[model samples]
Target: MNNTVVVAIPATTANMGPGFDCLGMSLSLYNEIHMSLTPGFINIEIEGEGAEDIARDERNIVFCAAKRVFTEIGESCVGLSIKLINQIPASRGLGSSASAIVGGLVAANKLTGSRLSQERLLDLATEMEGHPDNVAPALLGGIIVSVFQEGKVHYLRVSPPEGLNAVVAIPEFHLSTHSAREVLPKQVSMKDAVFNLSRSALLVAALCQNRLEMLRVAGTDALHQPYRTKLIPGMNEVIEGALQAGALNVTLSGAGPTVIALTDGEKPAVNDAMKGAFQRAGVSCQVKNLKPTVEGARII
Candidate 1:
């Protein structure tokens, strides 16, 4: 087995409206990690995204994930060297942490003869990430509907429709996932629960059946988006503007300061509308049109 490996993990968007902690889709954007085993030393080099904020030593999430692989497989690595080229923005709901965790696990597994199976890797990733929503797609790619059940992650991957694309309006500020979760109430009303359940199920069906027009209904949420809107200035305007500009659906991307719109039409118009709405609401943001990618993490 090779002692070094390069893994490219795609950025993922979770929730996709009403699926809350269950649905996610991988985007074309990626973060690449070049990892190698070294004796008696650990080093990490980060370029792009959270270069200044991300830890560079053993405490780094990449290193911690790689170490988990070695521990799980009963192998020993004296040290590790990790180089990250981050294309996905950090803490803006783009699955940056999931990419790092998946990249580290994949790269280290390769370096150590790949003792762990993909299922095992998924389980490990879920353990680290606290949920399978983002990590499932980051590891397996495409659209993933996952749940943590009976101490394991059960997931199904749905192939994105031929023309489906995402327009993401990313705010300049960061919103931590912790902060977002804190805003959520401990127990939602049964009416809201049923509301999300129907929409989440509809989202899954729409993706599976290639029913693009149904996405607008599927993207409506009654769970987290309503409460978290205060955390993201102009969230409602961004969603409304994107939809008005012909996007099929729009929602907060993961625990977002980023809003993503799914569109098979007028992507540029949707992009401009999302940006303009944020600007009108006194928020500065950047927009990117990213395609859905079926490919996940892999050695390169």
Candidate 2:
């Protein structure tokens, strides 16, 4: 068997606009993990953005996924060393943990002679991720609509329309998904729930028909965003700026301080407007133009 395997998984933006935990798209940004079997104890390495203080041992997600796979198969092996080169920001709603989980599982699957099929790998990834939206798109690429039903995951892929670019405006602050969810109201008004459901359906229809104009209305959310916005200062300003600058739509980029705007023209204009809004609102932000990934996770 080959002693080493390297896997690359793309960053994902989930809950695009109004889909909540049901929609996601993969971005070009990636996290790469390399695994090699060695003699002694397990080891892990980290690099790039959030690596400065990340754990370098079994406590890491990569190591945890690898160990889960090994234990599941009842296989005992020599020590494993994992090198993680992360381009995705941690806890920024960019699927950083999803990438790690998928990358590690892919590495282990390859090293163990392909014990799992792609579907099986995805199931494992979804299990580790606690949600299918981000993991599905990260593992399969493109735009995905997913629902977890009766212990099974069902998903469909949709191609992004031409001239559509993802403008990610990342704020300097961090908002953990757990903390964000905690801030949401447990019960919503009937009117708000119906409003979100209607818009979410419209958003799906727009994506299906590649109707960029419809997104302006489709992206409206009454379920999560209204409640979550308080935790994300300047959220409304950024969205308004992106729309005013002619973006097709703008929404929370996950449970985020990072807002993603879908643009029909050159991304720079939208990015500039978004950054300016953040600045005017006294929040520091970085902007990046990301193309959708057609390819998902792959072994190298």
Candidate 3:
């Protein structure tokens, strides 16, 4: 077995409008993990974003994932050293946790003589993640549609069109997925349920056809977003401002505080408008223009 391995996993935005835990796409942003076998104890080092307060010991997600893979492969415990270079922000609807999980597993797989196939690795990852949408796209890239069915996983990839750019506006505050999910109602009205179902299908069709105009209707969600929007103080204003500023569509990114706007151009105007809305709402935010990553997770 190799003594060392390095893996890079891209950050992902899941449930890009109405897909809600079933759709996602990888972005260019990444978190990198390097692992090497040592003699006695587990050691960790972290740098870049989300590093300052993150644990540098076994409690780290990378360590946990690596340990899990090693145990699954029947490998004896060796001292392990892990260095994480994080570029993705934690708990902001970007797949930071998924990156750590995928990175560690990929490194562990490479170190253990590649005993796990891609399917097995993804299965392990989804199990660890508790959901496959973000992890699947982060590992596979492009636009991914996934569903867990009959004790097996099924997925398909579609190419994103050239004219669209993803404009992500990230707020400074953190919104835990747990807290965000807690806001959702236990039961939804049949009309609302049907509304989301129709929009979700429309969203898929719009993306497949690169029909930017259709996104205005397709991105509307009556299920989770309405309940969760109150958690984000200026969510409605941000969405409205971005759309009015020429965004093709706007939606919450993952479990966000991070709002994503889809546009036909670079959409600096839309980004600025969204930022202004955040500022008016007394929240600080940063905006970046990101393109869909064609490749997902990879060892380097």
Top lDDT: which candidate number?
Answer: 1
RMSD of each: 0.8, 1.4, 1.2
Instruction: Candidate 2: count the clashes.
Output: 0
- The Cα error of candidate 1 at residue 153, in Å, is 0.8
| TM-score between model 3 and native | 0.97
The C-alpha TM-scores of every prediction are 0.98, 0.96, 0.97
* Candidate 1 local lDDT, residue 128: 95
Which of candidates 1 and 2 reaches a greater lDDT?
1
Which pairs clash in the backbone of model 2? none
Compared with the true structure, all predictions reach lDDT values of 0.93, 0.86, 0.88
**Tens digit of per-residue lDDT, candidate 2, span 21-65:** 899999989999999887688888888968986788768888888
Model 1 regions more than 4 Å off: none
Give a tens-digit lDDT track for model 3, residues 5-32: 8888999999888888889989889899
Q: How accurate is candidate 3 locally (lDDT)?
A: 0.88
Q: How would you encode candidate 1's per-residue C-alpha lDDT over 15-68 as one tens digit per residue?
A: 999999999999999999999978899989999999999998888999999999
